[model samples]
Target: MMEAVKRFVGPKWRQYLAASLASYGSLCTGMSMGWTSPIFPQLRGPNSPLAEEPTLQQESWIGSLLVLGGLAGPIITVPLSRYIGRRWLVMGSNLPLLLGWLLAGVASDLPTLYVARLMWGCATGMQFATVPLYIGEIAEDHNRGALSSLFLLFINVGFLLAYAIGPFTSYWGLTACGGILSLFYVPFTWFIPETPFFLVYKDRNTEASDVLKKLRGTSKEAVQAELEGLQALVAREFKEEPKISDLWATRGNVKALGICVFLAMLLQLSGIDVLLFYMEELLVKVGTKISASDGTIIMGAVQVVTSCITPLVVDRLGRKLLMWTTSLGLTIFLGLIGVYALLDSYYNYDMGSWAFLPLLCLIIYMILFTLGVGPVPWILVAEMFPVKTKCLASGIASFMCWLAGFIWTRFFRDVAASYGIYTAFWVLAVCCGVGFVFSATLLPETKGKTFDEIQDMLNNRSKEPKPVAV
Candidate 1:
């Protein structure tokens, strides 16, 4: 495994560095724009008179509009990657992001903030689609999983940083810090390269070879071998142009699509967003009278640490097995939290020992999710679809992901308000159970497979065992 990684990373260190930097750009946007959610209850809590602040409510509305704007990209991202290439899209999309950040930082009203967030979401979604597509295309088969997993790790880092800043800036102010952080995009565009696959897609074979050679710094023979592998993978995937109809017309792809949607939905409804959006309230209910501010920071810390464990082990455990184990474990933990909440409520919130249990259970649930569904699904999205199906499938799949995010964010507040925190957790536990069974039965292992070979595995064309690298 070390030899295989060296063969790719030896010559391709520059390309790897560029890709990693661009990935940071995407994640910084994700982390910064949404930092308020995790700590919203603290900054504008029900207990605080500032709860009436239009700013916090508007931020939620803006988040919805932002997701709506992102939904538009599926129409163009496929053809855009095919025509203009992924690198230029990455370069060009930053313009809107920059503008959005400027507008948001300066905004004083709901309307202005809404428009800013909408535009930011569109550009940010483009980055999300393009970054992984670009990274997966550039990485040599032997090292792609580890490299792609880095994107997930850095995203959590961004989340950790953003959450840290949210509370930090509350002491300082939002506008100043947000504006300063937004400028990171300028250097991102300056540094990253166009994906070699995009060049190949346009029939710029020589440029593609040059990019590949730069990224795969080994002997001439090894470089040639790497390019040949990529070319073969691309050739196999692109034999047919993917159509929207293919989603339903092909049974195997449809099954894979269904599984992706299920996983995406499960990720959201499993109360991950609730944990993010309402950590303070949940923590208070369960027994800790800790400030919402401190609770948000603790939640962020858990997320960052737990997410670190996934990248280290995901390539080794294989995707399906990881999902199976964690989904089941998460369900049990969530159920425990629900029981604790119910029991505590009956005791008039006086059972301090029982109250802390929900907080402890939630931490365990977050760790389990980070180890499996959090990063693995994104990696699967990058690897599962063929070139033909990749655009629409990814678009639809991503839409499902954000849609689920939207639902959880919008409804969890109301649910916690009406049903009580205990019942809310029970609902999440049910979803986790569904996710575990679906994963164990329907999701296949895609570890150690080439991008094209994964498409083949999805289609069931090659059944002979593909070797799993430890």
Candidate 2:
């Protein structure tokens, strides 16, 4: 299987390695989020300065503030990359994340804690915007989908590690151990190269060609052809500086941007964030006595195990098949979880048999959700846009994703409180149904096409005929 994946991936393997490191960074961020959440309760115990209260207001504040910071961070990465290059910008963004983690480790007040989370949020948003961009830029038409799926795999790994550690926070003395672990990323930024597209755009063709040769390890003739193809594409698509408003001005871009934004909103409407952050609480709501923090570790373990399969299957199954199938599966699993919660709330019969059911359903949901929408949108948003508007378009799309995330976190507590868990699951089920319709009609297959081919496909412009292999 490893050899087969390598064979199918062709010459652009090194680029994928770099993209995977960025994916590692993304995974670390998610792990950090959940890892920190369960420990907040510990921090509030009698020994610590804070007091533990599972209040909706406080949870909402933490979730929404991080999202708000995510909303604001990625908008600037486009121009900054254009000016300095992808490598430096990615490196520079880590400062805030590291600093925030350090601050949170020592934080004694609610305001200080919020500030640390805000910075971490900003780091996460920047990763969402830029990692896909970096991967998409360096990938060949045949392997882009596979390369992009790496994001999903590593992040799930992070989620799994985060959950696994939540149960051990007391053993480690404080959650500060996790935050300090996050700070180790500060040195990795120096090791990766600037993306090939950034090199070419700055008129450093020789350098770009050199990087291409090293990354591809193909014959000089093949390397030259690939470099020329990239140069021509970049020169043709991005000859002019992209304006932010361009995402809305033209019909093609508007359709493109609309699809991306709606998809982002749709991805969140699945309630993945709420499920992830509060998985323990939701499990308890269905009648488990295990501590929410310990439950979080179990949730993460399930996510990691399930997510391990996505990268293996994503490229082979094709995007649409994987997406709709997983969406449907998630809807069913969520429905089961909600039903279990409702039953536990209204009835007091034997709860042990049903006890494991909620946990089982949550695990199934994580698996299905990872299989489909979790990683594909980030890859699609990065690939679908023309180089001219790639940054601005992806930025707006990511911003919409974070915005929807904020909405979900803000209302999740109240919805669970008032209507019960069933209502929230029912609402998300309907949203997933709508996403099925939109994806069937609007989301194009981006698996085998080059960026130009995709743009032409989207624009109803024909690709010039290729010579027969003979």
Candidate 3:
């Protein structure tokens, strides 16, 4: 077993371990997102864990509070990362994550649940702001997409866990499981050192050179060359560390931030979060042939399977192509779902065999979603910004991403409740069509490109002769 593992892991395993450990926070976030999928029914039904059953409005709050708290976390992460560094921040995040789960595990009332979910969201948002920036610094251009896309892979596994396990586990039992998972991040962190870019930026060149050697598994000369490149980039970019205002300083920065913000909005407006959080409820309404619980589990399993394929193909396929094609694909698939929702909900039609249409539509929807907008936008956020404004820009973009999620998930239930779910589905389908147009017209291909190249492309300066990133 050890021989086989060594054969697979090879010498550059430190970078992978570092990226995966940092992304452990995403697993906790996924559990929080997926928790509502199976548990929503129980929360509002006879199996209620709270003192009283939650109404639809209350349930929306229950679902959106974590997202609402997402808005708060990025605000904290930007400044905190300056002092603690990405590795430490990623490690310490487990405290709040574990606390959130413990609160859920013992909660007896609605307010406690709200606070717990919000804490979960805050912890997730912090990771979102830090992990990608950390990964981008550590990974080589050749495999950056594959490594960064692990963010989605791990989170989707968390999604699968909740959907698969939530149905059978008691309410508190599931929370306990999540809290246990949160503790693993610390041990993972112990195995990996701080990112070489971060160490260089902090003026610890000796340590940075040593760490880079370990992460790159290269010889002294090669490591020294790599270290020098990072030193120049860090010296130039960090002469004065970037502020939120600095993101708007250069046209490249402005364009990069805009593109990232737009993509972030596009990702959430696709309404993937609504499905993750309300899969059981949505299927129950769709009247699928399979039980909603079964459908939710299958959908989640599909996410994990499909997500695994993304990291393999993302670097090969290129970012813009996958994003453009999948955006259109989502537009088509989501429209099909809207049609079934229209027939079933708006017309009050009852059919025998056609009941499988929504289920089929959603299955394909998850496929396209997981392949493209679901994961690619986050990668783009990590790629587009330069090191100078990376933390600030990333925090801004993540804030927009979660703010959009909160808006979409908060009102989706109410929209479905008010005008029938068909109305909500149709709206998302239209927005996805817009996303398709955006990707084709504006989204730059980040495949095999460095951050400087990406920023230049965003600013229409890629063709001009210039030095590589300092």
Candidate number achieving the greatest TM-score relative to the actual structure: 3
lDDT order of candidates, top first: 3, 2, 1
Error of 1 at 360 (Å): 2.3
lDDT of 2 by residue, 1-470 (tens): 64664676555656666777666677667765665455545654665544444356776776667777788667768668789877776666676677677767676677877897788788888877777677777777666666777766667667666666665656134456556656666566566677777888888988888777777767666688877877898878887777888676666677777777887787888998877766666766767656666667777777767666776677677777777777777777777766766677766666666577877777777777777878767657667776677788777788889999888877877887888877787788878878777777777887767877777777788767898896
| Per-model TM values vs. the true structure | 0.85, 0.87, 0.93
All candidates' lDDT scores?
0.69, 0.72, 0.82
Clashes of each: 3, 2, 0
lDDT of 3: 0.82
Candidate 2: TM-score?
Answer: 0.87
Model 1: worst 10 consecutive residues (lDDT sum): 42-51
lDDT of 3 by residue, 1-470 (tens): 64564567687776777788788778877988899987877776676778788889999998898888888778987888888787887776777788789889888899899999989888888777777777888888766766787888889989989998899977877888888888787787676678888788788999888888888877767898888898888777777756678888788778778888888888899998888898988887766778988898889888888987887766679888998899898888788877877877678788557888888889999998888787787777667776666677778888999999999989998898888787888889998999889889887788888766776776777475788897
